[model samples]
Target: MTKAPVTPLLDRVHTPDDLRKLPKSELRQLADELRTEMIDAVGSTGGHLGSGLGVVELTVAIHYIFNTPDDRLIWDVGHQAYPHKILTGRRDRIRTLRQGGGLSGFTKRAESEYDPFGAAHSSTSISAGLGFAVANKLAGTPGKAIAVIGDGAMSAGMAYEAMNNAEQAGNRLIVILNDNDMSIAPPVGGLSSYLARLVSSGRFLGLRDLAKKFAKRLPAPLQVAARKTDEYARGMAMGGTLFEELGFYYVGPIDGHDLDQLIPVLENVRDAAEGPCLIHVITQKGKGYGPAEEAADKYHGVQKFDVITGEQKKSAGGPPSYTNVFAKSLLSEAEQDNTICAITAAMPTGTGLDKFAAAFPERHFDVGIAEQHAVTFAAGLAAQGMRPFCAIYSTFLQRAFDQVVHDVAIQNLPVRFAIDRAGLVGADGATHAGSFDVTYLATLPNMVVMAAADEAELVHMVHTAAKYDSGPIAFRYPRGNGTGVELPETPQQLEIGKGRMVRGDEKQGRKVAILSLGTRLAESLKAADQLEAKGLSTSVADMRFAKPLDSALIRKLMATHEVIITVEEGSIGGLGAHVLTLASDEGLIDAGLKIRTLRLPDLFQDQDTPDKQYDEAGLNAPQIVDTVLSALRHNSAGVEEARA
Candidate 1:
């Protein structure tokens, strides 16, 4: 049996202020308790596990050394901030992570004053930290900005962009490169630890400043040579030549887990009267927990699990997830056509491209966290007569919208965009919800946008995208499993801009027409059933394409039905906006014709279950029925009571 952590030191500590009161000798014990507490908290409430566990000692060290809430400390991606949250007066609500009205899975500004900036995305910490640093400098404040960025996040160009401009911040900016997975440098040891201490030391910086002044008196050539010699000598021992080139005094390859090594080095950087510094700290993901250390990626984000066994709770059997379905469909297509290639921006497993990579390693590309590069790369492949499916999460794809418009859409390349998670993502919350992709992509010229109604439709859309090489095409699917729809053995290549009737059409003389987009067809049908019970005939149509709307179907519905309701699993400027434009252009709305739209609300929804989220957004079945009734001069109170 694992020994329970003795948290006498931890129980007394409710905040970082409490932690500063304890002696440095007791910090190691506090770190141990913090680790145990984090693991136990995440066990009851599933969330990001490994990253937070990896940063336990670092979190303690930073908080203990710096005056938090005054000195800004930003964690890149915010997945590693749980331990930091625990240390900063949120230990009581630790178990309520990712639930409705609970602590957010990522760092949230509204939740605490300690979080200076809200961050859930990767590689933005450096830029945000620089803003804080420069703002403090301009105000002539002693408070510094510290950004702890992961190695994976460094793959993006934004981090480098921030680093190149970090000179203005000078001594006010401190960047800690958290090298956990990528061994960017040699292993950390006593020798590496000593160098980090020396380089970051006040005495070393003082001497370095004195040397720079002395070198300036010589010729420009000698000055250049002296600088190169000093930079190269340190660069050879450590591995931050690239960071050094970006106008930062680079230090380290220090062991992050050791508080003894961390505390002093941070103190040196904190007290230094020099330019912006980059400290490279090496840590292991899932450091304290045994099972997590064995399988870091699996524990990176997890469902609830047993504390001792490290066995995650297996989800009850259901239909295949939309991601797996897309992967399978893509792999099947690639098997038939050698020209088909798969590209993912550092999310092979999340996008289900790992299976494709395992089979056709040559055709698979895992571009590390750089969505812009991934989009352009796919465009290049497509321009060269290859069918490259750029599979990215809708939120991540937003990072590359410029490339999508300039490189793919304007050029009219045959880059098949597989947009995963195209709606409200449950536990990941607002930062990860794919709410804006349909609105953004549909507005772009020369782009075909389609959303899958079910798993079978997803299979068909995949086949459709692979076959169509005329222009840039995109297909979006939700984040969860399908509605237990049967998998099609032979996937059909759907006709572009055409829709199918899921219920009664114009022939039935329906008074109510429910035009649905994406996976909202299921809920629309449910609304139709309630409408039918209330002595009202309702028609449901699954409009597959959002960009190239089936004008004939929409025109017919608007002319025949008295009440027309458009429902989609996206934001306001999507299908509803397009349909409104269509209606105004053609003057489709006749006398007494009512039109209503059901979509996600304007405000950003917080963390909750998928059902609760949809209900809150007013996109569920009852809400759809209510929208239809409200449009018509009918009693909507019946549906409201049923919903209750």
Candidate 2:
């Protein structure tokens, strides 16, 4: 059993101001309590437990050394900010984490003053930290700015872009590389292994600076002879000088868990840093807890669990999630065809491609958190006549928008895009929500956009995408479980741009219709049922394709129905926007009819359960019914008032 932490010093810390009053000796005890508190709090709420646990000592050391709020400390990806948040006056509200109207799961500028730069995505810290550093420099302020990023996030080209620019410009900036050897899963590519080797050898700083000093201080005649000898000697001792060549003064391979080693180096670097610096601190991902340390990826994000047993609390099971279904379907496809291959940007498990990777090892590629490279690489495979499917979360795919446009769309490559989490992703909040994929992808020439109405349709769409070798085709699915519809074993191909009418009674004069896109079909059908009981006939259509919309079905529905409502699981520039565009072009608005679009509201959604968020956005069945009734009431009153 784990011993209870000493807590007297912790009770005194209400804020960072209070923390400053404590002596360095008491701060050590306080760090112990902070770790205990984090463990206890996350045990109840069950969020990003492993990341917070890994950074407890680092958090305490940073706060103890630097005067924050004034000193801008940016956290890359924000998963490791739980300990920081608890330390900075959010301790009492820790229980309300990821709940509706409570503490956010990730860093938010609006949530706290200490979180100066908000982040939910990886590899953004370097650029954001540079911005703050530049702003401080321009303002003639003498404040320190530091960016703490992980090795996994370092794979992204944007981080390298920021590092390249910072080194060239020779700005006085600090970048802490939190090396954990894992990013949800073990990191891929040679760069990851190279960094691992550099850290493992433990002579990065000694050899690097010694070589520099030897090269600079040598006589002119002897310099050329010494340079080659030093290069050979350096290679024998440490690995390549990638970061140094990029313009950073590299330091460390230090133990992140040990405060003694970390604090002194940080203090020295903080005082002596004149140009851009990279301090690589090696740490275990799930440092404190045994279960988490053993299964780092599983504990990265978890449901409520028993702290003692480390077993997840069961919440009633129903249908398999869309992710699971997609994984099975993709695996099934690759089983039959040898040419089909799968790829993801550091999310083999998240995108449900782990099974595919296992079934066909030769056909699977797990590119380290580099979305831009993933897309262009997929295009290269397609160019060479290989069927490549690039499956990525909708939010992450936004990182490769330019590549998707320039590389894939321009070339008209037959790249299949499986865009998972393509709606308001609950709990993870705005940064992880997949809102803009439909609008962005739909606008591209020769690009096909699709949304799955149910799990069966998702299987069909996957098959359709695999078979179609014309151009780039994308199919988006929501974050959670399917609607319990029985999936088909034999996959069927769907027409590129057709909409299916699910439920309706258009013969009667009570002609009001709800047009649904994607998973909202079930809720729309439920609303139609409620409307029918209230002596109003409602027609519901499930629009599978967003890009090439079924003009025939839409035209038929509009002509028959008095009121037309467009509902979607996504945002304003999505299904609703596409329907409006179609209606305007067909001159249906001038033909004496009422049309309104119902989508996710135009505001950043907060952390909540998926059902609660859908209800909050008026996308649930009861909420949809209320919206339709309100529209009908206004339409009826307008007719009555105009006659009067």
Candidate 3:
């Protein structure tokens, strides 16, 4: 358990080509150094730790084996790609992971040549890898394409779809199914169970061969024969299987961490000139590290930690986070109302619903990582007169947009969406950013969208969503701690589509006005104060509801202020777009009132601290103040000089 000093090998690796030159024996030493550096790096900046540790050897082996810049290797979900980042020429920038203008937490094509394919979301790697493989074949390039996907990710329909199509295309492709036995938590669903059995049985080389025992004695064809034999055996052994029917030549149940086992099997799969192949390699979640191996989920994503003790660095703070508050409030409501129920798409602890699950086991549902099913399931429960609260991360909810539109919104189901991680999520980068939900959900006909200003507001939103049986209701709150706001004794429902004025002078000569949404209210208030100090009076309104635009408040602000600025945490089609649409309808533009909307830029914002990200997006206090002043000066110049 001795801590090794960060060595020169760690320092020198700024690219994969550099890594390819080193001897295979030196890789073990490099992996040890990489693990130490990763532990140390993530210890300082809170980020995903255990996944990176689990993939160290596999990452090393793949980069060493494949001609990376030419041969594309796609990583699924990107959470586990931290070590991949380190070895693939981003080692020097590793310290800057998740910081503004720093290294991204996931695979990004723009970041390096090694990351030929970028991924932030789960269940996307296989499809992306197939694209690369097909492209390589068309170009007649001397390159290989591989997808290192986990067993948990394979449960998703998209991966299977890719496998079906890839096998039919008959391209030389390799798929390494990294069976880590955990996906954030112990993986769920039937696919996970089948994979577990696959691991236990160890590749089905002799399920029942009518052809002969010598098929097992054959070299490359052994995998093909085993899959054919296993398919027939599975008809009677369990149920008629789905994978081989899809056409993928399934191999493995190999030990992933065993370099000897992994290298040769991968070599065999690589050498074989045939259709799509899957190498199912079983690996413990936290292979090399002891603490991570013991507590896989806890170490899944960790804060700066003491490497020796495996204790996360504590931030001196107070009170429950918004997520915790929402969970507690929901549980309290569920206790009183039998009709109240909760559903999460694979996230239990992350959404803080573990408490609710403990209290009301019957009402709690974890629908694996299937967001689409989670939404429709909530809708179904609502149809039966139950108030179902579907708690999911804002980014994840994007995957179920069609369900929200068709099933819940169209039917006007009483489904409450308690959306966590609503705003700028730090470190995880653009792939995990919850920036588009406000826009996407707000436009739906019967849907109600609300954002929490603080923990207290989140409590109210939770109560509001629970009690109101009108239609589908959504309440969004940002990631991390609340602003130390005291929670109400009991939740109170706010009037729908009504906005609360945060700061403004009723008599001030309409110099400026700001309508803000979500957690960005604090920054807007600060900017208003700064604008007031400079003899530039300003008003700030918290447009709590993104949907059902607060028309009364918008009209009032338009009448008073000469300049209007809308601010929100989401992207192009969000709160700002709604504001502009309202303005155009009211003919505010023709009235010569200057208005500008501020939001996240068109391009993806890289990994950074949340505050830094907002600042970069021009949503911070200084940026807001500067934007207002500049707009005012431009207006005054055009009018005053011409009148003079």
Best by lDDT: 1
> How well is each residue in 1-644 modelled by candidate 2, as lDDT tens digits?
34444577777887788887877667667777887788777778878988888888888878877789788889998989998998899988988888888898888899999999888899999998888888777778877778999838888888988988785324447888887873332323444434434532325545656766777788877777675564444333333356666667665556677676666666766665347777777678778788889999998888887777788777679999999999999888888878799999999999999999888889999998999999999999999998999999999999999999999999999999999998888788878888888889988998999999899999999999999899999999998889999999799999999888788643434458888889989889888887777666788889898888887888788888877898887778877787788889878775557787888888888878888888988898887776666666644335344224
State the weakest 10-residue window (summed lDDT) of model 3: 199-208
Query: In order, what lDDT does every prediction score?
Result: 0.92, 0.81, 0.79
lDDT of 1 by residue, 240-282 (tens): 7888899999999899999999999999999998899999999
Q: Indicate the worst ten consecutive residues by lDDT in candidate 1.
A: 635-644
TM-score of 1: 0.98
Candidate numbers sorted by lDDT from highest down? 1, 2, 3
Q: Which pairs of residues have clashing backbones in candidate 3? A: 14-89, 15-89, 43-304, 98-607, 98-608
Instruction: List candidate 2 segments past 4 Å from native.
Output: 1-6, 168-171, 182-240, 505-510, 633-644
Who wins the TM-score comparison?
A: 1
Winner by lDDT between candidate 3 and candidate 2: 2
Local lDDT at 194 for model 3: 51
